[model samples]
Each structure stands twice: as C-alpha cells, then as structure tokens.
Target: MELRHLRYFTVVAETGGFGRAARMLHVAQSAISEQIRDLERELGVSLFNRENRRVRLTHEGEQFLEDARTVLDAANRAVTNMQRSQRGELGKLTVGFFVGGMGPFFSSIIREFRRVYPGIQVSLVEMAPGMQYQALQAGSIDVSFTRALPAIHASQLRSEPLRNEPFYAVLLRTHPLARKKTISIRELSEETFVLNDRRYSPAVFDKVITLCTEAGFSPKIGATGSVSSGVIALVEAGEGVAILPQGSRILSSSDIVWIPLSDKDAVIDMVLAWSPKLEQPALRSFLELVRRRRKQVGI
Candidate 1:
C-alpha cells in the first residue's frame, strides 16, 4: 500500500501493541490500527496474533518484517540523501565496532573527520564480530573497525590495515602470577581466564584456544564479557585474568597489571572495513582520517 502503512507496521512490530505504537508514532491509536489492517489486507496475510493482552508476530509476519523495515529505512535515507546532495557530503555513515579495534585511533579519527565535515552525521554501533559482518552485508552498516583479518572475504571489501597490536596477559595485582615480569601461554594452565565475547574478539578467542591447545593445556576460561572494559573490570575484581590486545593498555585498571606473553607474542591487525559499493565522500574522508591518525600516533 502506501509508505505510511509500512512505517505503521514497523512501529507496531517493534512496540508490539497498537496503543503503545500509536503513542510512539504520535498518531491516533485508531489510525495506527487502520493502517495495519490495510497492510494485512493488501498482503492477504495476518501479520500479528493478538492474545491475552500481548502481541507477537506470526511466522509470515516475522519473515516480512525485515523487508518492510528495509523499504521504510531506504525511503528515509533517500530524503536525507537529497539534503546531502545540496551540501555535497554524505548524509550519514554507520560504523560498526568491537572493543579491541583501533582503540584510541578510532575515536581520534572520528573526532577529526566530524570537525572537518560537520554536515555529515556519523553513528557508531558496537555489535558482536559475527554481527558486524552480517550488518555490513545487510546494508545496516557502511564501515567497521574490526580485528577480523582479510582472509575471511575481507579482501572483497574496501579496507586498510591500521595497526598491529600485540596481545598481553592482564592479571590481578594480588595474584601470584602478577609478580612475574612476563608470562607464557603454558604458565596460564591453572589460571582462571576471562574470555571476551565472540563478537568483539573472535580472532583472539580462536588464537588463545589454539595456542593453549598447542601448549599441552587448554586455558581455564571462566568469566566472560562483551566488552574489553568489562573483562578488565572482572580481572580487577579477581574473577579471572584476560588476554588483551595492544592499545588496550590505555584502558588499564589501577588494580590490574598487564604482562606480555613470552611464547605467544601474537598480534592482531586493526582494520577499517567498508564496501567498495559505498562511495560517500564523507565516508572516504573518515577513512583518510584513520590513516592520518595512525601516522600521528606512530602506529
């Protein structure tokens, strides 16, 4: 039907109720209901099942939600594109990230880029590593700061390696292992290890596991966290020790100490990833700033 119908459907599906969706859309409750009814009738399918004062999407509705949201989002972006055309810059850039990627360089690059291109709006979204790849393919993200290496179809996209950061073992200040000037993967056999959630450090997890396996002992992975800050905080609380990539030293807690791995001095290459199909001038400038910041920081 009309674009308004798609908007109403998305609002309803997201809020899961006509009354609340109406409040969010600032439309009359009856109007919201009328639009959804029109949408369902036009599609010859029921989108929602109403039961016991709760609402949920049917199987057909669940499958169609993504298509509807895409149509609505594309329409909105078209409007922004027209305005950006007048300003000669991209309207918006959505960049995805995980914690260990680019660390300080990521923020510095964005700050400098926005300073020069105030008209272009940039949004940062933090998602899991696998989700970052999925988001990029889904057109939900334009660029990503990720530890995923180029071998994983990363070469198919437009990307540049920003820096390589060595991994370090972070231990609690009170732990006996903390007294050591340096540690190795084999030495961490009995240590409780905090793992980073797979989205932020997929490569790290794989590498750590592989290294531990090669050393004749599997690391005792204990607590887990989605962000580097959370892992560091857990280490400070004595829950477990964690392996951190280089540049994360900047986020060190006062009660924790970082020691390099003697035998496992492996590192990850921080990279900036984007689709070559995405040719926004502001996005291009943003990537340039990342390179400039790397040079400035002597990375």
Candidate 2:
C-alpha cells in the first residue's frame, strides 16, 4: 500500500477513531474512512474493529504500525542526507598537487578549508603538472594545484592564478657563484643547466629557456630529471645547476645553495585548475573558499 495509507492507518490507530484522525490530519472523516478501507482491501486484512463509539486495532494492524514507522524514518533520513550533499555539506573531494605543492601558503588554504567544511573528505594526490592536467581532464581528480602550463589549453578546463613568485638558481655548494646573494641569468651562460623533463612542466621548462635566451644565451642543457625533487638531487650530485621556483628553497640540501635570479621574468605562477564540466556542490564550495582566502591575503 502507499505511504499515505500507512500514515492514515497509524494516525487512526493512535487517535482510536476515524473522526479524530481526520481532524488531526486536517481531512474529512469520510475521506479517512475510505482510505483505511482501501488499505485493508489492498492488504487483504481487517485493520480495525469499529464499535459504536470506539475503534481498536486488530493484531495485523499493531504489527504493521512498527514497520511503517521504521520505513518513514529511513525515508526522512535519506532525504536529509541528499539535501546535505547538494548543499556541499558532505562529500569526497580529490585534490591533486605537484612536488613542493604543500608550500606554506597552499597548506594554509587547505587548513582553513578543512576547518570550514569538516564533513567533506579531502584527499591529496601527488602528480606532475602534466599528469595533474591529464587527471583533471580524465575526471580522476576533482581539482589541482600546479604550475601554469602552456600545454593545458583544454576548453573544458579553467585555471585561476593564485600566486606568482620569482625563481631561484640552485647550484652546488662548491660553485663560486653559489656564494653570491643573487646572480643574473646571464652569468650562468657558461655553466651546464640541469632541468626537469618537459613532460613534468612544459611551462616551467619553457620559461627557463626564455629567460636564458633573453639574457643573450640559450641554456646549455647538461641533464634532465623527471620531477623537481629529482632535478634537485641531480644538482646535489654535481650534475649541473638548475633554476627552481622560489618556494622550493624549503626543499633545501646542505650540498646545494639557492641564489635568487635577477631577471624579473624568471618566475613561476601557481594556479588552481579544474574542469568546468564536472561542476558539483563540493567543488564550488572549495573554489569559493579559495577566492575568499585569496582576497583575505590581498592576492
């Protein structure tokens, strides 16, 4: 039978009379009586014993009342949970990041988001810039924090620049230029330059090349690593010098020294990228939080 049938049966059972149930439900007594009769016919069981002035529930009616209440309670809870999900109050959000992605600023934003939406499950996946873009496009990750890539020209994806910081020259401690507080990109023309593979971050690789070219010399490619950390390790092993984002100083090594680049163009942009096609309440809430955080910091 329908939910209304169960409700009408329960109300009549509780009130002990058709007239009282109808009045409580704001319906005609005759309407309640007809619905109850319909319920009994559907169930093939008499639910109530009607007397001249009183009504009493039969054995089957008493048993059915408990099940009806349970079913209604579960239905109500399901509706509430659906509403919560739609409002971005609860769900899972998969976030992608590259090496050194947990810089102070990015980590702070994540902390604040967790504080605000504790019900949303946030998980992190470490990937290169190229892989992050691919994952985002493939719907494997919800959003990503990565360096702005020139190769990511997908129309379905949107990127928002969050931070722009200069690059630093990473060199072996024994190198004479390592002692300098800052150096121009032109001074490194004679040295072998270690760089991460273009597949890791084409934008960063291209930026380094452009900066060196603008300084009247193309970078002498001495070595290449798959990721930023690997490039740093290669530098530590004296493979060659490399340029890295300023924030990468946090991944320092005793054998390596980070010297700031004098060229203003030797910089990298950190951005948040996501696919517009997969818009959802949780993603929207997170993007809004990012905007609010950026405003608070005057970024």
- The 0-to-1 C-alpha lDDT of every candidate, in the order given, reads 0.79, 0.87
- What's the true lDDT of residue 90 in model 2? 83
Per-residue CA lDDT of candidate 2, range 166-205, in tens?
Answer: 8999999999897999999899999999997998878788
Candidate 2 segments whose C-alpha is farther than 4 A from its true place: 52-54, 151-154
The candidate that achieves the highest lDDT relative to the unseen native structure: 2
Clashes of 2: 0
TM-score of 2: 0.91
Residue lDDT tens for model 1, 1-299: 98988888888899889999989989999989888988899899999998747689999999889999889889998998787755546568888986556566677777887887787888999876666766776779988987655256565566677777788889888888888887887888888899887765677777777777887998888888777888898898888889888677767877988898887446766777787776566676677677777787887
Question: lDDT score, residue 228, model 2?
Answer: 82
Model 2, residue 86: what's the lDDT? 97
TM-score winner among the candidates?
2
**TM-score list, all predictions:** 0.62, 0.91
After TM-score superposition, the amount by which residue 64's alpha carbon in candidate 1 deviates from its true location, in angstroms, is: 47
